[model samples]
Target: MNRKIIITGTTCTGKTTLGKKLAKEFLIKQIDLDDIHFLSNWIEKENTAFVKDVNSEIEKHLEWIVTGSYQTLLKDTVWQEGTLIVWLDYPLNLILRRYFIRTYRRVFLKERCCGENYETLKSTFSSESLFLWIFKTYWHRKRRMHHWKNTLFSHKEWLILKHPKEEQKLRNLLYDN
Candidate 1:
């Protein structure tokens, strides 16, 4: 398809899932920022290094579905170059519900994260929990994406997917190739 796609949104919005599906269907590479951003024990790669590596990796591929919300880290470079920017604007309640279920499974089932970090029951219920983080950032992220789409990425192509119930609609929009 010769597409350079960026699938982004707040947590549990299916950005990574859609990216993987598209990449597999198209036989193109898929890049998840989480994979490049974190290390063992959930430690972060240095900001400079992470940005460099991500940009370098993106530059090497002609077709890819890049998923993540690290827009500031990328300096708008990827957004400016993307063929399509998919923003999954799901409801907060839905996101929270999904996050809770995912985290619960991770804690009890020993599901490993992108960095090979496992969630602990203690951590899952803590103030530092990803659930809390997502709760706090959901609205902010939606606002920011809106602003960027109109401002920083005004000229780029965009696909704003909202509400998961619109399954056939989403498929139709995405399969427009």
Candidate 2:
């Protein structure tokens, strides 16, 4: 399938994983919004520069999968031109479990992530902790995503996977295609 796809979901709902899998299956470029929005040392790129950089990178590709939860990034022309919007609507418990596991792996394994940043124990417990941020914003993010799905993207084609089984089916289908 030659398509421009965007995968979005709450923290740890596997946006990046799905994006990577789709990219590999389709033999298309994959872009992670976090990589453009966050720099080394966890510094955030300026809004204009971030948008410009993301737009420039995406414009160069005919078919690609981009993943992230940034709504601002969704406003870009690339998103408007996207052929598919995937919403991973797993349950809160599932999302939290994944979040904790991913965080543990990142902190313990010192896994490098967006912009080559590592998740240190100190940072994970600090005011900037992704865990903490998720706790504070989970509901809000869910609501926002729902609103976007019902409104902003109501006209777009979407695959709203709400369970692990559905995700597996999607993977299998993508592989077959």
Which candidate has the highest lDDT of all?
A: 1
TM-scores, all candidates, are: 0.92, 0.90
Which ranges in model 1 have alpha carbons more than 4 Å from their true place? 167-174
RMSD of each: 1.7, 2.0
lDDT of 2 by residue, 69-94 (tens): 77655565766877777778888889
What's the true lDDT of residue 38 in model 2? Answer: 90
Kindly list the per-residue Cα lDDT of model 1 for residues 44-123, writing each as its tens digit. 99999998888899889888789988987774577767888888898888888888888877888888877578889888
How much does candidate 2 score in TM-score? 0.90
- For candidate 2, the per-residue lDDT at 148 reads 71
Superposed Cα deviation of residue 59, candidate 1 (Å): 1.8
lDDT of 2 at 12: 83
Predictions in order: lDDT: 0.82, 0.81
